[model samples]
Target: MASAMNSLIPAFTFILALVTRMEKLDLKVQSSQAKSIGTILSITGAYIVVFYQGPPILFSRPLPNLHSFSVSLQSNWIVGGFLLATSSFLISLLYIVQTWIIKDYPAEMVVTLFGCIFVTILSAIVALIVERDPNAWTLKPDVELITIVYSAVFMVSIRSVIYAWVCRIKGPVFVSTFRPLGMAFAVFMGVTFLKDTLHIGSVIGAVTIALGLYAVMWGKANEVQIIEENVISRVDSSSDKVPLLQNKSMEV
Candidate 1:
């Protein structure tokens, strides 16, 4: 699951760029080349960080016995990877469509609220079919209740609305570029809370990802500055040309 996500950062980024036409891969358009390079760097960095689990740069967590885990779940890596990849592709497509919708509708709250409701219903139906055990459906009002409420309110409702609004403003490509950071954050939390191992490869990957992040940020800043400069230049040119218009006008 983690590896699939790391590999898909650039995939999602490039796909969103293509969808929005920020990148054409044309030699004449330097913007496309720069974007491509940034995407490559970001993707490579993500892969390195995720795939390279070298000797621990810090304390290593003891590996749990494989026997303790469910064999069926443990053996389903191939299926799990495929599902994650598929979901990633769908999410990439989703952002593109969502951006287009926001332009027309301009109401992110409607989308976020209804979207949550719709997904909850559909997911519930699917979950019912998949889990079969009624006992598993039973919930206790302990930590689980708190977790459910927090996740529903903060993660789903709040985060989705913010994401939708940002998607409208920044477009999906900008949002997709930052996805690799999620992996880094997950690793950090795992190490801190779960006493997970700190691999040397993970350190290198993290550093590479940081560099890639800087590169992306620099590229985006330059693009924004150039856009602002172009707008100012256009305004100035239009103002100058306005004076060239003939003052003489016949009665009409």
Candidate 2:
């Protein structure tokens, strides 16, 4: 049931992106720029998925069975959840800073510095919490917590900033196409790092996701091209009218 729920998340995200006009559906008018952005996003998503999911399959000996969900969280799950939540919030706050600070500073430098600061703060907080409540904390180090923090700090923060910068230079569609890529990366990372084995159903779902992403990009590219052509044609017609008007005024 958890796996099924997880599998549907990507589809949900894709649907949301489409509804928000963050992606396209046509292919004939797809832009090379969108394709470029999409490729990176896809790769990133793939890597993330593989990392997160692959472990269970690869290390099946230690992992819970697919049908099992009875494992108690105990203190470890609480500590880990707290860490994950805190890290996510910190990363989001940093992302806001990046959105505003990039206007005045080099985005890459700002993001990198913020990332370092976040790591330091996160470490300090974890240490303090553990020190204060040693007995209350989990005995095991939370790998999930660590992974979430890393993903938010590096993947979410850096990628979002890069996408924003790219959109400013190129266009929105170019950056929007990356949504699919991010999904792909998540899937890939889950499988690879977590040792999650992909069944035929998962593979089929992934392929469908790929196709949907392509459709969205293609539609966006067509829309952009059509708008550009219309603007140019209007400008040309206006320019020709101006010359004609000047000639008529001179004769009068």
Candidate 3:
């Protein structure tokens, strides 16, 4: 479910960018048409993953046999799906906010540091509210402690810095185009490490997401090429006119 939601991040980001006027859409342009179609496909694939878990194609162990639609309707699963979707949207929003900040501040490390600081504070507050037992706060010198330190240093801190720098260079929509890749990684890790069941729906959805990602990336590349070409043409025209103006000045 979380992986499915991850696939929707790019679609959400594109929609938000369009709303904010950070992204433009022209139906007449092939690049824009490709982007729009890709967004639709990405979103459609996500929903299919969430709601239609077809038959299990591969499973390490025998699991409960229930229809895909029934599984989706479970109250707990519904809540989890909602939360995952909300998280994906928030992640996209974070990308947009980071892009906006980086444009003005132009300091990736500083922005990452402040973002981590605020996140830590908010997490502490949430932890305090949710975990009433004092024993939960104890940090033992074990693998759990090591994992926490590793995540804090590498996953949160280092990842944030890299993402901020990328967001500064590329727009938020560009950064979001990679979200579908995480879904692939997550599926591989879960199936390999946790012996999770792999279903036909998931496989189909993942492939659809990949296709959509490719289309969107191709469109973006074309757009960049067009922009560069326009810039070069303008410069050439300006230079050509400069010689004509010089000749006119010599005649005068």
Candidate 4:
């Protein structure tokens, strides 16, 4: 469910980019229309994933203990969904801010470092407040420790730097367009490692999100191509004017 919400980041980023005037939208343009449709598809897919959980498809054998937590998941579904949506919104906002910073500073690593530091501090504060059990905070020499180290290094550190660099080069909307790609990995991992039931709605939602992402990518690519062509045309026209101006000055 969280992953489903996360897939909406591209749409959120697109809207934010538009709001910030970093992106232009003309409904008469095919590319802009594609982008708008893509955003709507992504949103529709997310809602389907949240509201409609069709019959579970057999993916893998569930662990014997799987049923124990099903009730808890159902109970907290609304709250978790709300939090996930909020997190997605905040992530989109962060991408916009990161792009703004990178535009001026052009420092990916430095931006990522500061971002990770503040995020860590904020996470720690939240953890301390929510986690009442001291044992939950303790890191043991086991899978938990390994997971923490891996997430800290790869997910937080490396990924942050990569995202920052990409944002600097391609802009945040372009960077965020890949968010739906993670849905495939999330579904695979959940079914394989977690032995979770695969729902038909989830599969449909994931496919819909992927299609929307592709549409958005195609639209963005076309827009870039058009902009480049316009730039080249302007340069050619300006160069032609340059010779005329020079000839006029020489005659004078």
- The parts of candidate 3 lying over 4 Å away from their true place are 1-7, 62-86, 243-252
Instruction: Give me the displacement of residue 19 in model 2, in angstroms.
Output: 10
Q: How far out, in Å, is residue 23 in model 4?
A: 1.0
lDDT of 2 at 203: 51
Model 2: residues with Cα > 4 Å off, grouped in runs: 1-160, 167-196, 243-252
**What's the CA RMSD of model 4 in angstroms?**
3.1
* Ranking according to lDDT, highest score first: 4, 3, 1, 2
Best by TM-score: 1
Residue-by-residue lDDT tens digits, candidate 4, 49-158: 66777998866777877667544334677888899989999999999999999989998889988988898899999999999999887778999899989999999899
Estimate the overall C-alpha local distance difference test score of candidate 3: 0.82
Candidate 1 per-residue lDDT, tens place, 194-220, comes to: 778788777777776677666656666
| 1-252 per-residue lDDT for model 3 (tens digits) | 666677778888998999988889999998898888777777766666667779998886633453334434436887888999899899999998889999999999999999999999999999999999999889999999999999999999998888899888768877787666566556667678767888887788778777777778788888889999999999988877757778899999
- TM-score, model 3 to reference: 0.82
Q: TM-score for all predictions?
A: 0.83, 0.45, 0.82, 0.83
What is each predicted model's overall lDDT from 0 to 1?
0.73, 0.52, 0.82, 0.82
lDDT of 1: 0.73
Q: How far is candidate 3 from the true structure (C-alpha RMSD, Å)?
A: 4.5
Model 3: ten consecutive residues of lowest lDDT? 62-71
